[model samples]
Target chain A: MTYIIKTNNLTKIYQGKEVVSNVTMNIKKGEIYGFLGPNGAGKTTFMRMLMSLVKPSNGEIIICGEQVTPTSFELLKRIGCIIEYPVFYDKLTAKENLDLHCEYTGYYNKKEIDFVLDLVKLKDTEGKAVKDFSLGMKQRLGVARAIITKPEILILDEPINGLDPIGIKEFRNLFQKLSKDYGMTLLISSHILGEIEQIADTIGVIKDGKLIKEVLMEDIREENTAFIELKTNDVKKVAFEISHTLGISNFKILDEATIRIYDMKASEGEILKTLVVKDILVEAITRKNHSLEDYFLRIINGGGMNA
Target chain B: MLKLIKLEIKKFKLFNYYKGVLIANLGFIAFLSMIYFLERNDGNIPFENFEMAMNISSAAIRTTFIIFAAVLIVKLIIDEYKSKSIEIMFTYPIGRKKILTAKLMIVVAFTFIMVMSSTSLMAGLLYFAEAQFDIFPVELSFQDIVRNVYVNFFYALATAGLSLIPLLFGMRRKSAVATIVSAIFLATVTSTTSDNINLFSIIAIPVSLGVFGILIGYLAISKIEQVDVI
Candidate 1:
């Protein structure tokens, strides 16, 4: 697939220190790419580079087939962005704010404003003043403003930073719907892994200004490592008995009463049978898998899964 | 470029503070008229009284005009800086210099219109009241009134121009309060003491203003182009 966004050795420095080191990333067209990282991990800096907000210290970014430069207005025209906290004029109504954004985007259609407002489920809030909006509502409004012009690519940095669960769900649903219906490419960064996992087609993990991993959702799911968790009173005895009896060693004792088996050869039934024979009454047995959060933390903590 | 200017103007309108400013200007004129009526003695004042009123009003209006103009300019620019919206704004399909120029132009244009409209309305009201009440027997000709109008026009424009100094400072400091205080301090010191200082007096205010504008413009362009917006 052709990449819509591509970067080569992109870097950013602040106060004689590199905030984003030499990094390269590729975002395919018509896919939702999730940028996962910790706070101040250079996610926002990368997005800014894509949008041409800050001049890259070295290297290049290509968005929508246009090379990003110091003043690449044409390239930026097709991109929508919310770098950090979405800020708008408090005195204006939602529609007025959208209208101002429309002017800058060169999309002057009044009908498009309502269309975007409805898309973000903010139709009823058209006339409500922005100052009175809740954080979630403002976030929804920020998304609405970003998509008002039907931009080809949406670059959102922590779009759901302060959103509640319901707001996050709504945003996920909105993003999924937009990607499916409009085929717009999205590059979103968020610390909330579950939300990103739910909607993103591809995942990128960033740490210390470097792209640690990039993989498709399907590939990650296919190669997913199963985590079989077992809880019993005698965790050590059970773990030793299971390993010795079944000849399986790819297991971890998660806690005093829990053992997590990563190997697939030791079937749950066979292991339970062996445990029963050993007189280790397992209180609970659960077939678990690595969550996106687990995967993110694993990668961040230098415990990355071999996907 | 025009579209971006339109967008910048929309931002100014969205804030709605400028509307209140217009209302305050009208209200101030009404208050001044009320005070004039309260103090007036029917058909008896000398020409010296009219001259005294003009002088006092000139100083008051000049100071008021300059402060308001600077405040409006600083408000327009500093708000964008404070909210980090400048980062978002500069990403649009417009040159950075063009965006700054548009914002500066809009603020200057708005100040000019408000000052002119408020001053003319106040002048018209004063002339009408004087005609009706015959409070001042000193018969001022149309030419004299027109000359005063011309003076008011130049004065208002000059006051508006004076704001450019603070605006340059505002762009550099990114602080509205700093712009105001610095502008006030400089204007007070320079305007008051220039006659005492032979060198300053010899240069003339207009010449100094022009030179300052060029230097400040250079500083603004350099600073804006290079400073990282985070």
Candidate 2:
């Protein structure tokens, strides 16, 4: 597979501390690569480095087959980005700001400006100054500007920071359309795992300045471990019966009232029958599949084991 | 580079600053013309020394241009840093040096236009006051007008160039107050001594400062690629 964006040992040091340390990842062309991490996990710092907004302390960034250096102006022309919060000339109107952005990028199509504004649902702003805009509106305008040129690659840092549910859903659909219809590679970072889970084809989880895991969402879904969870009254007696009677070692005792069976050797009916026979008062039992949040939390807590 | 500069100019909501500068420039001219008129009316003041009038007028206009340039630098460069808008500009495909150059060019050009226009307006008003009131005994000549225009143009250019000095300090600290304060201080110092200096020194001092400012500006631009955006 051809990679549109690749980083090798990308690191960023600030005042003797490595905020982003030795992160190497590949983003395939036309794939939506979601960057998932906790707050202060160096996701923004790494994205800034890729955009060349922040100089990397050490490592290499290859974008569209060109190494990103301080002088990578030509390479940057192919990428659209919103680093942190969107900023604009507050005095200028929304349309004016977008026009200025187009001027700088050497792409000026007046009709396209209206199209993008419509895409972001800012079509009726009607020359309102940006300072009067709400945070959500500004974010939509930022997205409009980023997509105005129809760039080959898009890098957004917390793009949905202040959007309402409807706005977020619209942006989700817009991102999907951008990638699917235009074949544009996207690298988006968000602290909301569910948001990234819904749209991202692959995910890169970073923690403590390290990129701990890069996994395909498809694989994660396919390899999802479904387990039986039981809530009971006699927790000790239930644990003994489950292990001694069921002969299943791949199980975890969650709490005083709950036990999870990861090994699916026996059917749910058999397990319930065994528990009932032992008089373990099972209050409730349900089968559940491991979610991306669980996978992410496990990776974060376990130092990247089985990612 | 020229296209970048043009884009920068277009981005500026010129009416906001231009209206203020125009009113202030006209007010300064009226105030200075009144002072000249009053001074000539006094018997002790020499009315035939056109050089002194030109020198005083140039000093006042130069001070005004200095402040104007400082405000422009603050708005164009320092405020961008404070508001973090420059981060967006930095991510663009254009070189950081080009952006800096465009900002500097706008400031210099604005200062030049404001200063020269105000200086000419003052000169014309003073001449009309002389003709109407017959306060000054000196007869204004074409040679004097040409000399005044030539001297004021160079002086305004120099003032505009030296405005970059405060820009350097402001950009280094990313402080608008620092930029404005330094410009006020520089203007006060430069304006006070402008009266005592000979014509050669008036041209040389600001010219040398302009060179220094340009050097500092280049230094700032060179560092733009390396510095981390906050």
Candidate 3:
């Protein structure tokens, strides 16, 4: 497989504390790689290291086949990014901010600026300074600046931050189009699992400053491990029925009144019938396919079967 | 490198603080001219000797422009850190050293231009006043004019160079107040030294400070490529 971004045991240490510990991951071309982690989990640090905004204490970052260093500036021309929050010259208008960004990147096409502004829905904000912009507006302008140059790779650290729900949905579509139509690779970090689940081609779960798993979204979908969840009145009665009467061995009692049967061979109708016969009231029964949130939590909890 | 400098100039063209500084410099020249006119005849005034007048005027103008230089350093360097815009700039396809060099060059060059132009303009006005009103005992000489220009040019350069000391401190700490305070401190010290020192030492003091400031500036720039921006 051809990888657009590859890191070899990347590590960042601040004041002798490892903020990012030996993280080795790869991002393929034309794919949205979602970096999921809790707050202060080194997601921002790892992204900064890739951008060379922060020096890595150990390991190497390879972007588009070239190793990244402080002097590897020419290689950065192909990359666009927004680290942490979108920052701009507050005195400059949104348009001027984008113009300055384009000029710095050595790409000057006025039409491209207009195109990106329209793409990010910031076209009407022509005369207003960035200081007057709302958080959502600034977020949109930030996206506009990042995409103005039509870079080959985009590394966005919490790009959808401060956006409304509709704005988030719009950006999700925009990201998908950018990846599918423009063939741009993206490395995005976010706490929004559903959004990441919807857009990402691959997901990397990080915990305690270490990357615990890098799995393809497709693989996660295929290995979803469907389970039948039951909310009952008598949890012990249901558990006994599921084990002795139903002959189902693969099951877990989640709480006082909830049970999940992982055995795919067990029929839901038979399980319900046995529970009803035992005078156990089934309040809600749901057959759920494991979601990215589940996988993320499992990985974080150190119970994930695959890494 | 030239392109980077040009880009810096373009970026600052619309900056309000930059325009404000330019206007303030012009205002300062006018104020200084009025002071010279009002106090020309009074023994209490310090423009009794041609050399002393030139030194005092150059020192005053240099002090004002040095403050401007410090302001520029805060706007261009420290503000980048405060606003977190340096992260975006650092990720661009340009060397950090080049960007910093361009910003420092702008500060130094701006200080030189402002100080030189203001000093020369005030000097011309002083001479014009002297010719019209016979305000002082010592008449203006062509040689005095030439020496004043030569000495003030170097003085301006030194003042501009010395601005890097504040810039260094500010950039290291990413503090606007620190940068401004240091600039003011340096300007005051230099101005006091120029006033008390002999005529021969006027050019020597600022030139030495300028050269020392340049050394520190270069050291600061050299590390831009290696140090973490945060």
In terms of DockQ, which candidate is strongest? 2
What do the candidate models score in CA lDDT, each in turn?
0.74, 0.85, 0.83
lDDT of 1 by residue, A107-216 (tens): 76889887878877788975689999988888888899877777889999899977888878888888888788889999999887878888899999888887888889
Candidate 3 lDDT tens digits, A57-151: 99999988888877999988898888888888888898888888888899978889888888888888878989999988988898888888889
Interface RMSD of candidate 2, in Å, is: 0.9
Off by over 4 Å in 2: A230-259, A263-270, A278-286, B40-42, B46-48, B127-135, B138-143, B193-204
Ranking by TM-score: 2, 3, 1
Please list all clashing residue pairs in model 1, or write none if there are none.
Answer: none
**Candidate 3, which segments miss by more than 4 Å at Cα?**
A230-259, A263-270, A274-289, A303-307, B14-46, B193-203
Report the TM-score of candidate 1, chain A only. Answer: 0.85
- Model 3, C-alpha of B140: deviation from truth (Å): 2.6
What CAPRI grade goes to candidate 3? medium
Q: Distance from true position, residue A120, model 3, in Å?
A: 1.2
How much is A256 displaced in model 1, in angstroms?
16
Arranged by DockQ with the best first, the candidates are 2, 3, 1
Assess every candidate by TM-score: 0.80, 0.91, 0.90
Candidate number achieving the greatest TM-score relative to the actual structure: 2
